[model samples]
Structure formats: C-alpha cells, structure tokens
Target: MITLDLIGIGSGNPDHVTAQAAKAMDRADLILVPLKGEDKADLAGLRYRIIESCVTNPATHVQGFDLPVRDPATPDYLARVSDWHDAIALAWEAAIRPHLRPEVPLKVALLVWGDPSLYDSSLRIAERLAKRLPLTLRVTPGITAIQALCAAHAIPLNGLGAPVTITTGRALRETGWPAGSDTVVILLDAGGAFGTLDPTGISIWWGAYVGMEEEILISGPLAEVASQILETRSSARAAHGWIMDIYLMRREPALP
Candidate 1:
C-alpha cells in the first residue's frame, strides 16, 4: 500500500510552510517535485528550496520530474484538463514505481502550491493514480492565496454577515459579476479579468507574487486602479517571466 501525502507549502514563501507541512515532508520516504522548464525554473527552484529547508532526513529521496502540459489542441476545456490530469497521473506512476515493494507500505509526498482543494488538481491527479496503485491520500492544508491576498491588504474576506463568491478569471469574464454577493475573491486570473466588470461601484484589492520578496500590492476603486493594475501586472510578468496573482472585488452597499 502507498500513502500519498499532498502538503500545501503556501503562496511562494518558505516561511508560509506550516509546522505540520514540514513534518509531513520530513516523514515521507520520497518527495516528487514537478519541473515546469527553464522559463519557470524559479517555480521549481522554490519547491526544491522548501524541500531542502524542511526535509532533513538523509533517507528521504527528492526527485524532479517534468510536468505534463495540457494540449491546447483539445477542443473542449474540460476534456483538455481531464486528459492533462490523466497524463500527470501516469507521470506520477513512472516516478514512483521503482520505489515500490511488494506488500510493503511506502509513503510518497508532493508539495502543492496552495491548499490541494483550492483551485488545484493535485488531489484529482492522485486519485487518478490510485486507480493503478494501492494508495491512501492525506492532505496538509496550508495558507491559500486568498488568505495571503487578504493578509497583504489587511482586509477581511467579506462584509459583516455577508456572503462572498470565490471564482476563477474565466468565469468572471464569461458571466460578469456574480449575483447575491457583494464581495468576490478571484484566483488564477490571467490579468485584467476585472476589467470585464462595470467598475462604477466596485473596489478592488490586488496582489502579485504575494508572500514573496517580489510581492506587489495595489488597491483602490476599480475605475481608478484598473489601468494601474493592468500596467503593473503586465510589467511584473514581463520582468519575472511568471506571475501568480489574486484580487478581491466588492460592491459596497450591494449591487442592486
């Protein structure tokens, strides 16, 4: 049997690795790190740095493997993602099989960027891998981008006794503002998804490379800061070759 631990390391900050996450990393026999190519080497480098700082057990093995890329040729969005997950599960198998033993329990770990359940597909890929291996999954939740974003801005997630909608940039672009909520938190924004909304009454708080040394924070009424955010986000992405950002939008007094 295999015990697969998915440990969340938080949003790019080594300090964000919780005590429990560190313990899970140290306890694992093997930790798999995904490599996204030289263009984003820093992303993989950060994971390696986390592993180096936390996993002190000389017996713990760290292996880096190339992550599978989703095929843009696939017509349907969901189908493309499903195929990608399947390929990733196969990648996991190839990386883990050599370490397996007959009728013996082994522990494997993977460091996740954020909480495995929050807009992440690691758990799904693990479950897909379980179809071929005798596997049990354990999750160690860490601080999410949403939490980090709010912390960076020193703002609450929602208004007093109010509901908040959490969504992706694609949905926000396709559907505009969601109903029944004054506050919305968006993740995985490709940049300027908020521009699709009518900025008349909304306020926005945005952050990029959050919790890291390169952190950038911006906030103001949507109309005022929208251009600044777009320009800043573009420049930041160009400078770093990669960017992870989130934003919170609220229509105070509610959008009628």
Candidate 2:
C-alpha cells in the first residue's frame, strides 16, 4: 500500500512552506516533483529549492517525472481534463512501483503549488489512485495563491462586512462579471480575461509570481492599468518563460 503525502508548498516560495509541511517532507521516502515543460522548469527548480531548505533527514529522496501533457485537440474540455488526470495517475503508479518495498509502506510526497484544494488536480489524481490501490492519504495545507496575492498588494481580501466571490478566469469570462459582487477574485487566468469585463468604475489589483522574489504587482483603476498589466505580464512571461498570476476586481456600488 502506498502512503501518499500531498504537501502544499505554497506559491513558489521556499519560505512559505509551513512547519508541518517541512516535517512531512522529512518523513517521506520519495518526493515526486512533476515537470510541466521546459517553460516551467523553474517551477520544478522551486520545488527542489523548498526540499533543500526544509528537509534535513538523509532518508528522504526527491525524484522528478515529466508531466503528461493535456490533449488540447479534444473538443470537450472536461473530458480532456479527465483523460489528463488519468494519465498523470498512471505516471504516479509507474514512479512508485519501482521504488516500493514490501516491508515498508512507501512514503511518497507530492509538492503541489498553492493549496491542493484550490484550482489544483492533485486531489483528483489521488482519488484515482485510491480506487486502484489500498492507500493512506494525508494532506498538509499551505498558503494559497489568493492569500499571497492579497498579501503582495497589502490589501484586505474583502470589503468590510461584505462577501467575496472567488472564481476562475473561464467562469469570469463566461458570466461577464458577477452580479451583486462587491469584490471578485480571479485565478488561473491565462491572459486578457479582465478585458472581457466592464472597466469603467472598477478597480483592480494584480500580482504575478506572488510571494516570489521576482514578484510583480500592479494596481489602480481598471481603465488606467489594464493595458499596462497586459504589456507587463507579457514582458515578464517572455523573460521568465512562464508566469502565474491572480487578480481581484471591485465594482462601484450605487449609492443608497
């Protein structure tokens, strides 16, 4: 039976790893780090940096595997994602089976970016493993991108006594800005999703690579900074070869 430790490593920052996550890493026999592509090699490196900084014991080992690419040719997005997760689970099994010991339960840790609960597929992949094998799963939560995004800008998450709606870029684009929302936090945005919304009276606070040393923060009226954001985001992505960003929008409410 595989003992899986799904450790949230936080937003690409070694310092953001919690004490519990550190201890979990120390106990793990193998830490499986996924490489998305050449563009995201830095992300894998960041995971390695976290292990270097946190795990002290010599017993733990870190390993890397190329992540299975999602098939973009599939017309159905949901089905495509399901297939991708299945492929990832297969890769996980392959990585684990070779290193397994019959006497000792395999302590396998996967360092996930951001919290595994929010906008992450690690849980779904783990569920697939559960169906096929008798395994024990443990989750250690870490700081999410939302928290890092707000912290980077030094802003409160929501208005006083108001609720905040968190949604993805696709949902935001499809719905065309949520109604009755004082504050809307958007995640996993590819680019230019904010341009789909009405920018006249709204304010935006945007952050890329939040909590990392190379963090970029931009904010102001949506009309004023939207183009600047697009340009800056593009330039940064070009320089770093990849980017992860999140932003919040607040619309003006009619006076009582």
TM-score of each: 0.98, 0.97
Ten-residue region with minimum lDDT total, candidate 1 = 247-256
Where does candidate 2 stray beyond 4 Å?
none
* lDDT (CA) per prediction: 0.94, 0.91
Q: Write the per-residue lDDT of candidate 2 for residues 151-230, one digit (tens) a residue.
A: 88889999988889999888888887877778999998889899997788899999999999999999999999999999
Deviation (Å) of 203 in candidate 2: 0.4
lDDT, model 1, position 118: 96
TM-score for candidate 2: 0.97
